[model samples]
Target: MKVYNYARIIYYRSPLLVQILAIAFSLIIIFGTLLHFIEPDTFPTLFDGVWWALVSVSTVGYGDYVPTSVVGRIVAMLLILLGTGFITAYFASISGIAATNQQLFLKGETAYKGNEQIIIVGWNERTKGTIDELLTKTPPVKIVLIDASLKENPYASKGVHFIKGDATRDDVIQKANIQAASMVLITADQSKDEVAADMQTVLTILAVKGLKENVYCIAEILTSHQLANAKRAGADQIVETNLLSSFVMINNVLSHGTSPSLLNLLKEVKDSKVCLQEAPTALIGATFLDVTHEMLQNESSLILGIKRGASTYVNPPTSFKIEEHDLLIAIIH
Candidate 1:
């Protein structure tokens, strides 16, 4: 029973190509041996029978060795019928398997072995647009997308890995190698109710924070009331996308063209876009105006505000001094 189990394991583990080649070789040897015995008088050597079998199976009859006996001819005909078909089918199967494996690999079904990667959890209408923005605007970075709803990776792109699993699970978070990830984004599950979706996001944030405390987490909240819960769950930043959208739409209705300019500021074009970057160590004591002037001269950046602690001060007075852990909100071209 143990030996039978071991044989089954080996059979299952062996690649299709190896199995096909083994079967084809065994059939060739069996037919060749049979032909040798069928016409030993005409076929002087067993090697001659093998040579005829090989050529006949491959459909490349050189006519160097011909079977004379009726039984030998029948064997040859059998080889041509079975062997040729088997070989053709084997090659076709191999090609198909290779193509499928390649597709799976591209779809991120395979395990990822990347470090300092960005992991985006959940997929929704906004997911693809966010991914596109990151790919176009940010520096070259590997992104691993995690979602249980997706059948396969939607992007199938370079520098992107997909893991099909619930982000709220610790095992799934670990599979994405969240500990080594630079950042994690938990998008709202739009399919669920406002409260339910936010709770799901909070759960995922907790799972990720439990695994890696220092990793930056940005979660999308559907309702304003869930912001506190998300923050308590270890989300470094919470975005109320629905509220922001409402604000933008209302502002556009009140004053047209204002929203477009605001939207354009976020778009990546002419290498100019708004970004929130950490303040350099050298700019710790510099005033806002001084840093702004220096950035224009050195980095070609326009200092818009400082994100210090949990507060954002846009277009602060020039008297405001750069803090120790301030994030510079600026536009660069």
Candidate 2:
């Protein structure tokens, strides 16, 4: 008598199809052995008995080999009935696994592995402008957006990624690759207060900075009062949206239709009409007056501000000397 332990093998691997296959195989093998024992000389060898078992269970009934005894025939009937359910279940499990894998591949969720992208926290009306401006100004920059309210991402940019969650949480920030991010832009949610929004932004900034101290953080604030608090929270820069709006409104009132022209001039990109350029190290020792002529002549640019190391010398006159590592924001034509 050959002993085959099907239950033990099925227990360790335990899948629906595997369990069915084990049960069916066990039934066929046990019945074939029993047939051999019942009619000792009737059944040839173990191999022939297994072949007969397979044929009987599958309902092929080759007729070349047969179990003539009543007991053997009874076992054969049981094997045939059991094999039907096993075979059906086996194929069903296979179809299920295939369908699941296909769905996973279609969603593109399995291949999310990359680094050094900008992460934008929160989504609002400003998000549209932020995305548009970033896309226009910076080429080939990858952005990961984190927001809880967004049900579906409306924009379909190639390199943009979206994570649905609260950005204030550490795990959520990590999902957006906050540690490896080149910059983190925190925009206030439209429905929240300026202080509350700023608090959230500050917390995100602090969390990111805790993970990666070198990470650059920029936050948008609705009020000027939150600017100092945001700065204290390790934000590299704070953009006061109200201040910008007021400046634009004032410009429109003062210059009438000329405000549009001024805006166009400030934001011009192609043909180097008006450009902002960082100061080269070689020009650091020179005075503003020395670079003024060169800037106006061939460069066709005007020096608007001198960034000396960490300090900004805005609208510095011709007498202001340029310091080492100073960035000169200029207007070129």
lDDT of each: 0.85, 0.73
Per-residue accuracy of model 2 over 112-158 as CA lDDT, tens digit each: 24677888888888887777666765457777877778765545435
- 275: Cα error in model 2, Å: 9.4
Task: Work out the TM-score per prediction.
Answer: 0.72, 0.63
* Model 2: lowest-lDDT 10 consecutive positions: 104-113
Query: After aligning candidate 1 to the native by TM-score, how far in Å is the CA of 296 from where it should be?
Result: 0.6
What digit string (tens of lDDT, one per residue) describes model 1 on residues 1-333? 999899778877898877776677767888888888898876678787787788888888898878887888988888888888778878888899889877876555676778988899988878887787778755677889998888877777556789888899888888898878999989999789989999999899999999999999999999888898899999988888999999899998999878888878555444677889988899899999999998889998888899988799999999899988899998888
After best superposition, candidate 2 residue 175: deviation in angstroms?
Answer: 1.4
Scored by TM-score, the top model is 1
Clashing pairs in 2: 273-332, 273-333, 274-332, 275-332
Q: Model 2: runs farther than 4 Å from truth?
A: 1-112, 133-139, 270-278, 295-302, 331-333
Judge candidate 2 at residue 134 and give its lDDT: 67
